[model samples]
Target: MDKLISEFDRALRTVFAPAASVRPHPDAQIDEPAMDIADKRHAAGLMRVNHCGEVCAQALYQGQALTARDPAAREALRSAAHEEVEHLAWTERRLQELGSHKSVLNPLWYAGSLAIGVTAGLVGDRWNLGFLAETERQVSAHLDAHLSKLPQADEKSRAIVRQMHADETAHAETAVALGAAPLPLPVRLAMRSMSKVMTGLSYRL
Candidate 1:
């Protein structure tokens, strides 16, 4: 019952509350450049996708934390979740600065990610860590793509993406250091396929 409530609270906070980061946002100091309509639209689209990604991250980490049987693993998952909340808040603030709104399907994304996280957790701690590492690896790759695609003049967005990429890379490395087992090739491919679908749809929606 406690876990259920905790999960419910996390969902509510993620879906409705204004996120507050523990650390300062990377783009907080950078002034928003006067972007051309095309650049602004493209930047906004990418940031929206990023914001949605953080939402899914929150769900995934929270779900995994709930099911983690080992105290050390649970703490690790919760710590990662805390960092993801900061990322979410930063992206959300960036979206508003860009004159954009979040993805309309955010709740659906959260639900789906939470289900996946729970399933991975049920398989055991090593698999749970493996899933997280893979997720972060894929996110880092996409952030790289977004960095390449961002407008040259959009320094603020670029700063945020760079910091996020670094953080995700570190997270993946941490998972590996914690003895994460490598997932099977088929599972990895399926994860990538799901990510592709989410990214393609989230770019516009």
Candidate 2:
């Protein structure tokens, strides 16, 4: 019951509260570039998508940690989730700097991702880790895409994205080392499709 209560509290904080990061902001040293209105809007859109991604990541890790059977697996999920919270803080700050709001659909994204994470956890640890590994892999690729799309002058956003990419890659490698099985091609494809839908809608709404 205590664990359940804690999870509920975490969900509320993740979706509703402003996030706090332990690490220094990635762009703390970078000067805010004098971007024109269009570039500012574009950068904000991209950062919004990234922010929503971190929100979903929080949900996924929490849900997995809730059901993961192995103690080590649970710890792994929890550790990754902690880092994801930092990502959340970084992206949220970036969004504010760009003068934009987070996605209105963040709650929906979190709920759906939580369900998926729980399902993955119930499938056993190997597959559970596989799911996490795949998630990070896709997220790394997505960050790379954002790095390309972000305005060159917007080094603040780029710096954050680069740090996130490196962190995600490390998370994926950790899962693999912990005995993650490879997901089937069909499952991978389905995951990619869902990601596409989320990104497409999140970019504008």
Candidate 3:
């Protein structure tokens, strides 16, 4: 019952509470370049996708934390979730700046990611960490793709993406250092496939 309540509280916070950041936004005080309609639309779409990704991150970390048996592992997961709140806050602000709304299907994304995280946690600590490592690695690479695709003059978005990429790299490294095992090739492939589907949908929806 306690766990159920905790999860309910987390869900409420994630979906409704205003997100606050511990660290200043990467784009804080940065002057934005004048963007044409095409560039602005493209940037907004990408940032919206990024925001959706952060929402999924919150679900994944919180789900894993709830199920993690090891105290240290649970702490690590929760800490990661806290850090991800900053990402969520930043992306939310960026999306507003770009005059775009979040993905309409965020609830679905959160639910699916939470399920995945809980499944991974049930597999044991090593596999749980492996899943996180793989997730952060994939996200880092995804940020790279966004950086390349962003308009050259969009320095604010670029700064935010670059910082996010760095943070994700650190998260993956921390997971590896904590003894994350390599996932099976098939699992990795499946994760990639799912990510592709999510990104495709989030881009437009």
Quantify all predictions' global Cα lDDT against the true fold. 0.89, 0.95, 0.89
Tens digits of per-residue lDDT for model 1, 1-205: 9978877998989977889998989987888898898999899899989989999999998888778777777777888888888988989988888888889889999999999888888889999998889999999999999999999999999999999999999889988988788999999999889888888888898
Give the poorly placed runs of model 1, Cα more than 4 Å off.
none
Poorest lDDT segment (10 consecutive residues) of candidate 3: 10-19
**lDDT, candidate 2, 83-104, per-residue tens:** 9999999999999999999999
Residue lDDT tens for model 3, 76-166: 7887888888988998898889888888888899999999889989999999999999999999999999999999999999999999999
Better model by lDDT, 2 or 3? 2
**Top candidate, metric TM-score:** 2
